[model samples]
Target: MVEQADSRATSFKNILLLIADDLGKNLGCYGAEVTTPNIDKFATEGVLFSHAFTSTASCSNSRSVIYTGLHTHQSGQYGLAGKAHHFVIFDHVKTSPAFFGEQGYLTGLIGKVHVGPDYSYPWHVRNESATRDVAWVADQAGEFFDKAKAAEQPFFLTVGYIDPHRDMTRSGFGNSEIFDARIKDIPYEPSSIKVPAYINNLDESRFEFSEYYSSISRLDQGIGLILESLKARGLEDDTLVVFLSDNGPPFLNSKTTLYDPGVRLPFIVRNPKAAVKGIENPNMVSYVDIFPTFLEWTGKTQHAPTILAGQSIFPILEKSELVPESEWKHRVFGSHTFHEVTNYWPTRFLRTRRYKYHRNVAWRLDFPFSADLYGSLTWDAIRHSQPRGKEGDILVGQRKLSDYIFRPPEELYDLDEDPLELVNLAVDEKHKERLLEFRGLLEKWQDETLDPWLYRDGVSKRFIQHHLDAGMIVPDRFDLDLENIRIR
Candidate 1:
């Protein structure tokens, strides 16, 4: 292993970030049953973050936070692929790539760059990349790296893979023919999969979970190829390689929700030159911390253009004396916006080490779990299962709006006991104080972050009304925001 001088050990001239779409803790390193030898190997040589999480659950929203290092409620992108309106991290400030480029690094992005409209940002080179073939991407990235090395310029390469997202064309929900059939042997049963009571268990749900495992394996193959390319080009030692996902698996109570499976992501960082190695850091970190951490790692201290809500992890990387847990146990927040044209469910979540609380603003009934208009037919079939008997008559007959109104508005879960978030303790009098405390904290965060959706009578209403006028959405029959809208 190449070691850096102790004085400049933290400095990195080149950085390579690999982001997998919809990749959760399915790899072998995170105790999943999937076969990800290459990813596991990488984890063994680097620091694996046990408590890393994203700021939002949806694609565009989470990517916005990752790029800008701000919460989704702060970035103003509460939905999926759509117009670039509201506040955006890239819009208001220079991105991590741009900052590194200014410091004499050639920065480029390969694969999915689903932040906003394609025409908005021009600073980074966006490659016309897709996740159809892992080998092809490895070959392309190898060529890019070789050219950058020949030019003698440090590079910031972001390889985004859209694997395992969804194959709406597939018959088995998330299954894709591109994946090796060996994935079928992975042990994942619906009976073994613990889900929340809010979601009805069905045969299709199990099939969907099985398909999710298959997709993860396929993406792992792509990651293997990328790592091999780096080693083949002899750039493994010099490059700071980081691997993570934008959000959790897209399933019921997962994607577009503030649950742990939705926001918690796999985070791994490997710097062969750094002093630290083979360590699992249990410290809690968020998407907001990435930009500042990258900046600090590159040996730059300039203030970012936008208001950064993240702190630098340079001290941790340097193997300094352990910081108090209270110092690092900061609250992480998340939010959701209009996912599809017709479906509107907005929610905010607050998470700590032991507890997680969710506040639903606009709930819907009879709506699909994921608003993936382009999702695979297999996923759709699994999500819309028929109720068995009159015992489920209420769930079977209600409209999406009615379901939303009847659902619990506040949810509190002790993550230590229910890592899967299967139980709710919000109504328990013993936990009432804790719920109120988190609610108060959430309200304070909302006010301080300038969340546009908090006040119903201000520009937020104007914004919604404007979208309504533009035919973006229709005022639903059970819209709760319209009834309890506060003028202030």
Candidate 2:
């Protein structure tokens, strides 16, 4: 509501955050064959962050990190929401929307409101659904923009597009919904697409990828409508626009895991009256950095720098220059404790510009499968493939079934040489120093975050409890497993 003529107050009065569900950097802007022209156009007019990442690859948990500026460990949204698992954000946590509401901005969230207990993230307006009807969602967003303008209030809006996410129907992306006439059905040819190395290039994968691309094009259409809404309302010049995805595609080895295909995201930010355009930044940024950036942009940061775990990238967006070595983040971290209720495999990852390391806490156990990935067409083909000859006919996407199921305690990859992360250099004597260095960085980060997942003698301290002298329930948020039980 601050209508001063000061440049800061004038330039960034509103915020529009557009989040796509289960999407990765597979857009035409990112050199992928998928048609995301609207988002690609936004990237061309905005600052495209080449190395943005999510702290977790699961849906609700990643969005929680973005909204709360906290890792899953800190926010307590350990997995998906609204289930028996009920991994809601911590009670004391202040979400991004709630903070903006405090600063007199009308906060509105349309489409996939995946994370909650209503009290935790109190968005002023909530229109939640699983519909891939992007146009309908855009219409709702346009209405929100109009309302905010009428009230003469600054607004923060998040439109979560449910496109490109797997449909409930098998081998579908919801592209055939006749009710969604606003989205034209654009079918992709299976043979024309370039399959990423992380996924198999089988007929089933190709078919499903076609559906995925079709859904992505629909999501792009929604982006265009929302941008039009902003411009029509005359808020385009005053709104700080950000577009990203909650996680990766709903395929095996991408959505549930912390691999590049899973965690690396497409982040485009079009700051109002920015100094640069179409600049690709290579700085290491994570979803946790988002909350702080919004706070800084709106001049609503009340907490000390120590409280927020992320550093604001407003300077980067404003200048588009390489941040000084001291100010730059050389590595980003991720934690994936769960995807669905049953997928309880805990893993932590640290990725530098050159190398990536993953520490699988439950390495002895086979990685549990998420329900969607287990039932995917891609997985079906990989699971049922037969070895024809002595060479084994290039096992499922060139990865052995055993390797996919079983994991070593530590994994290190030189991403420059192995972008696909097919090679594990953890045990290689030649890369031992690099592995140890990355591992040390990861452990240090864990300690700084006070992550209960920190292991001592191979057991996660997350299960252990302390301060028991007070009462029966000892009250610790980090005890996610509820292993600390005092006999009643």
Best by TM-score: 2
After superposing candidate 2 on the true structure, give the runs of residues whose Cα lies further than 4 Å from its correct spot: 1-12, 303-306, 318-322, 386-394, 461-488
Against the true structure, candidate 1 reaches a TM-score of 0.80
Which residue ranges in model 1 land beyond 4 Å of their true spot? 1-12, 82-90, 117-120, 170-203, 317-323, 364-368, 373-406, 456-488
Candidate 2 TM-score over all chains jointly: 0.91
The per-residue C-alpha lDDT of model 1 at residue 95 equals 61
Q: Per-residue error at 152 for model 1, in Å?
A: 1.6
Question: Tens digit of lDDT per residue, candidate 1, span 280-342?
Answer: 777778888888887776777675545777887656653423457666654677777655435
| Tens digits of per-residue lDDT for model 2, 1-488 | 34443334344478899999899898989889887888888988988988899999999999899888999988888999966767888788888888788788899999888898788777889888877778888889989987887666789999888887888776888877864566677789998877878778888898999989998998898899889878886778888899999998888768888988899999999987787788888777898999888888778777423466788888666445567768777788989898787789889999888888999888878987887788888887776874432556435455666777898989998889989777999989998888878878887888788787887544454454342234334332223344654433
Q: Evaluated with lDDT, which candidate comes out highest?
A: 2
Quote the lDDT for 18 in model 1.
Answer: 91
lDDT at 416, model 1 = 94
